[model samples]
Target: MTDKASPGYADIAAHYRRLIEDGSLRPGDSLPPMSQVKEEFGVSITTVNRAYRLLKDEGVTTPRPGAGTVVSERLQVASTGAARLARIARTGEKYAPGETSVDHIAHLRSCHDPQVAEILGIEVGDEVIVRRRVFVRDGKPAVAAFSMIHSRALADVPELLQPQPFDRFWQEIYTERTGHVTTKSPERRTARLASSDELALLSVQAPENAAVPVLVLVNVFHDDQGPLEVWEDVYAPGLWQVEGEKP
Candidate 1:
């Protein structure tokens, strides 16, 4: 869940993302040189330049005259994930219908992405449902989210899919219908630029602030039944705040 992208430049960007995520690379940390990457990955200067450009475009790195591409000192949103969600909910945006402006759409279970598989603790081709949505506030795209519910948990609750789709949260509906106590909720946060998929889901134009920052807050809601829902939200620039935690 770090900056890990696909292969090639994506791989390189992922490496930096992991470094930052793991606290190995902090804000103002100098990334390795192109020559070093050339020596390490045995790629051409052009390829390294492309990778660096991608990171720069993603606002993970910035170029300076005296210094090279150093990590940008961004606003670190270090608050607890629940705290952030509670803050949003307190703003009258719980993301529920009538309570908030969100385009909620549910998709059939897919097993193409490894991240999805890993998140749901299922095989690569197993069945899992995803909810894709974009939350609008003040008529502007404020948040984009994807919530995955393992189909195994829904096998007994077939009514959840019927009657023109439930308007409430999946977790709430599940607990209400089955009386499952959703106990554990552990979460973490990360920052990255909105990808094309995220942008399309949120239906937003690109990069108004020279850097399109997305604050990703991922939380897994669970009970005795193991993870019931794995939800990840990517927040737009203004609607999300960034702060640091005391050590």
Candidate 2:
């Protein structure tokens, strides 16, 4: 009402945000150079900088050393399409395009952790198969996913012991192997200070041993038999959920 016609830095930020959400500007896609943006928007360089900073803080963009400000890899879900994001949120499925697992580890491990035991519907000391992966986009780590399956299911899903990620979704592999489709996948979300290990794995930037906030998303997958497996995903900083269904 005051001055709708006068474009401001917020307008600049919103323009790029829309492009990112709508898949026009995807993960690792660089934004227009500051000078070019300033010329197109008829704004000062300072104004353009402010807008870029705003986008960066919103996790919509990241500044690369030589590539300029590019879309954040974790936000690839936004660029992939909101419906796809919703689908992934509703059902644990494949990662967005361009997101790849850069590291994978699978092993049989003793499970004495109470929460892990409860999620897997196993005793505190029961052994479990643990599969871990570090997913990245544009060579930057975005999420660390840990999957735990009860040891008894090993015979049914021996692939869980494989060192590499399956060509198909793990959920699909499990379903095909056991004839138990996922009936329920309850998720629990929490925020906590990133651990030293998480900071290193997720490439979180922080002062030496300083606390950095992170979001932990845990999904307990259930089938007709009972709890099938549990996935604990840790997202890097700036990967928190935001409002708006689109993007």
**Model 1 deviation from native, Cα RMSD in Å:** 13.8
TM-score of every model? 0.53, 0.63
- Evaluate model 2: give its lDDT: 0.72
Task: Give me the runs in candidate 2 sitting further than 4 Å from their true place.
Answer: 1-97, 205-209, 242-247
Give the per-residue lDDT of model 2 (tens digit) for 114-183: 9889877889888899888887755678777788887867887787788887765666767787787875
Tens digits of per-residue lDDT for model 1 on 1-247?
2324324766666566545544467678789888998667766777788888977766667897777888767622223335435443343333322123456666566677787578678888877777676655435565676777778666756644442334444556567767887854556778887777777666767755445667788778777767666777787655433331111
**Candidate 1: where is the Cα deviation over 4 Å?**
1-99, 159-168, 207-213, 242-247
For each candidate, the alpha-carbon lDDT, in order, equals 0.62, 0.72
> Cα deviation of 236 in candidate 1 (Å)?
1.7
Q: Return the top candidate by lDDT.
A: 2
Clashing pairs in 1: 109-128
